[model samples]
Target: MKKIVLLLFFLAVIAQTAFAQVKKPTLMVIPADAWCMNNDYMTTYSAQGITMNVPDYKLALQNDIDLLNVITKIGELMAERGFPLKDLSSTIRSLEQSSAENEMLMSATSGASLAETPYEKLMSRAKADILIELVWKINTVGPKRSVTYTLRGLDAYTNKQIAAATGTGAPSISAETPVLLEEAVLSNMDNFASQLQMYFDDLQTNGREVSVEILTFDNGSGVNLESEFDGEMLTDIIDTWMYNHTVEHRYSVSDATENRMLLEQVRIPLFRENGMPMDTRNFVNNLRRDLRKAPYNIECKLLTKGLGKAVLVLGEK
Candidate 1:
């Protein structure tokens, strides 16, 4: 009897391990913005009368052989540890091919384009679960050389740094950036992987974090947060929908008024019912579609700024 109990326990443990291995988070490695600027791969982007300098990822990937080597090495290492990887250069190229003409989403009522940062555009295209930003330098001591490296794992949806590793490898005679980087990473990879796993575990338990905002168009439609349907204000109805849809009903209403509603720290599920990845836009679009039905019959426009924030403009598509 004791032998049978032990066998069952071992089988259960093996089953749990297999289950955990099935949904490893996908990761992509890119050079840090600081690294890009230092390497002279910076470009200007303008939005809403605000011009700012951002990393020129395409230029960097095309011109910097060392950057490509470093990214490939990190990707290989992470893949060995069972995490799926996305190639940054490939993603950029794919985006270029798909959007040959600059695609802009404009408001039908106002003729205004959606606001988006350069980084946001990249994130929306890449669609990786975690973004690994890497920055490295070579230290020369007399004739010997060493690598100083930093790796930051950011949650793609929230842009929050979940894990980080930084260190300098022991002085080596090798001058290859990839070789020195591999040495530095080998020393820290285990700890970094453990940290990443912990973050993923938390995500499985708590769901993804995202923000949502409800706005009304100035089209003179009698629809706003103050509008009532079946004796419940539009604000209350949306709040109840959020409560019912979010994972564990975890979300906070930061501000609410007749014109707008802001919801932050919203905990949405990681996947949809059919096992596809779920994002902020999809979640909000679900709400938008529901509101379009019988009792509400609301018309709304859905605009997503990046991976984590979505805006639904009510009272005009």
Candidate 2:
């Protein structure tokens, strides 16, 4: 009997340790300022030559629904990713109520409004090691429409921004704006969570130190070509370079080339032409070379050492 009791205690201890090792708490805060637009133009439509205005209370109710959806989706994603969801539903409900009150108060005043409200207070009350703030915006330019969102993670106690992610979703002026918003939020949830996880992993492995470097370059073709590269050109370049060199070559079925040769022959020339000092003729030649070598394979490394991360942006020479 004594041996059996000891065995049972040991098993219980092991179980507790395993559980503790897997359990992590995270808090997600979506402020009202994160909403796509300060003005809900959808509520300002006119029908039959009579302008129809949405009541503040009604708008508040709708805002609560939107907030609830965002919070629920985030909580679900976190739970799926091995984070404890403890009391998330209740927390979401509380946030919804707070959001409703804030929207109501803001509806009354056009210019002057409360600096801080119950909603902000409640969000501030959420306690966790990591906190994520989600902000979204909707913009219309001519006939083009765009939706943008940003996810920022911060240390709860220190209030220091740890990690951030930004992504844009397809935009349309159709009646499905709300549905589009939900889809965009859900689509980016994994990325947002992954960034937070990376931050936490860094904190455990290294200290609190992170760095970012932005290297802007012309396409290296000196033809004065006019083409829209959008804002993802840098990421596209890095991804293509990494895929060809390091990732499996199943896509193109090619053996890995020497890193140094690839860097000098293709990558260095690009930087030298666009980033380094050079004469106009040399710049145009370099640009022409890069343009002619479109779809070239390049390789680069994103090295993170002891909280210092650097993206050694490389291109085909």
Candidate 3:
């Protein structure tokens, strides 16, 4: 009878402990750009004297089995910590579908270019709050090997490196590549994941950071940034709009010129009122709408360089 009572008491404690731990900030893991190049998962493009090499996750998915094994093991570790893993392939397929739909309907109707780079599409569809990047190399020395690794945790909304860890694994048998990689990750991942979570918690209380820029065309027209609207210069108007729209009026003007205005450290709510994630693209669209109305009534083009930097072109694209 005492044994039965003790077992029930321990089970209740276990249940309470499990229920007390809640996870936040969904995560997606992918190989680092440099790591892919070293492993031959690369694609190159050249326009002038410059050559650009980008990671080919698709090719890596198909060809790099050993790297995939390490990635899978790392994901398993994330899962053990109660962090949900977003699948990259599934995100890609969803993005492809949404891109096609946007092109077919919205682009055709509005006559706007719906062409998005693969990276942007993935960013839109992944639904991940943080991106965990893994870069690693395995070196074989005679019968044993070691793995040197770097892991970076980036905020999905801000593209900031909130957490990073690097280390070299202890030597082990040459064939123990996966095991060595696991140990290397395990040694630092708990702290890395905690840092990622802590960043989101901080962002929740204090808003996410974003940068905005205003520029005009270099055409012969005299459209200067100093031009005034309703007695306020274009730069001042932009500042007022930012102050009115941003969270708690938290933003700073780094530089202003007759042709350009740079606004940095703009704080935005983690989620929009509609419960959607707030990103630079969406936030700038609202700014565009406002700028197209009222005294300013400026017709401008909004371009986002990834998830955090947004540029508003005053005169032309």
Candidate 4:
């Protein structure tokens, strides 16, 4: 009888170990080259009729460098998260030439061709369950400069689009125009990569079908506003609350009373059921009240007044 009981306990331990060994799906990230150009296909129809002639090679090379940086960063981030990076060097090497061409031509331009040369293309043929496409564009709008980035993930086998995200950022207009543009691109690159990783992680855990939003308000008075409670916030709240009723993620307080600050939006997945508590409302409320009382010490302040308002305004189906 004693031997039988010991055998049963050993079997149970082996079963638990097997269950814990279940591997998560691997995500494949395909970093594509950027297509930056002074003249897009639309340049063909301008009143000047594509008078600006710039070499497409420079733009393509710049984009390639930028994309490589993003890929390296993402690889580092994923390795830190314990996810395997599928070998992509062969696929990247196969992409000898990628170009973008304007398919449409305006008739009004007549013989004055406002057409842009087909930009190089960056294609990825990786065989993996998940894939990511990162595209960026640099633009100089008069005195202001900006960069637009697009991030998309698709199922490698099915070719179905899983997630898509877009972000744009600009630099302050100043005498150091070139420096500001570089800074803007670098900053936007980090933001784009971070968001892409978050979305990819969600898709890997949950089904590919999920939606998330992140909203930030920067009032000059240093007050930051978030709409719905997020995992990052909840994690901090939990760690702090579990130890002591305190807040952990605090934004700067603003002195401007005129509401000069505006709100920005970000999207995220709903849930993953990965150790996070299902009920977060009470936790949020308690955290908020604690912050109000001890605002100076807490790292974050939960804006109870604005949470409901944000839900009412930005609720999704």
The candidate maximizing lDDT is 1
Q: Residue 20 of candidate 1: its Cα lDDT?
A: 68
Compose the digit string of candidate 2's lDDT tens values, residues 1-317.
Answer: 99999999999999999856842545655533324245452235344456644322234435566555655655666778776543434554666676667555642224443343332344343434566665666667676566576767776534577777677777666624445555566676677677777766654433222222223223463211122244434334433543443213111212222121111111111113245422222322332344345453332223211112222324322
Q: Global CA lDDT of candidate 1, please?
A: 0.90
Whole-model lDDT per candidate: 0.90, 0.45, 0.79, 0.40
Residue 114 lDDT, candidate 4, scale 0-100: 28
Clashing pairs in 1: none
Write candidate 4's Cα lDDT for 72-175 as tens digits.
55556555555566645544445333222222323332433323232112112333445665555656777766666666666443355666666566645562
lDDT of 4 at 227: 20
Give candidate 3's error at residue 195 in angstroms: 1.2
Model 1 vs. true fold: TM: 0.95
Worst 10 residues of 4 by lDDT: 308-317
My TM-score estimates for the predictions, one after another, are: 0.95, 0.37, 0.78, 0.31
Ranking by TM-score: 1, 3, 2, 4
User: Whose TM-score is higher: candidate 1's or candidate 2's?
Assistant: 1
Identify the runs in model 3 with alpha carbons over 4 angstroms from their true place: 1-23, 46-50, 94-121, 124-127, 156-159, 170-176, 217-224, 315-317
Which of the two, 3 or 4, has more TM-score?
A: 3
Model 1 error, position 177 (Å):
0.8
For model 3, residues 1-317, the per-residue Cα lDDT tens digits are 99999999999999988755643778999888888878888887553456677677777877878767877888898888878899875666676667666666433224665545556667767757789898988778888889999989988767779999999988887446678888877888889878977897777777778899888976765666898877889888778888888888999999998998888998888788898778777888887888778776677778777677888888644
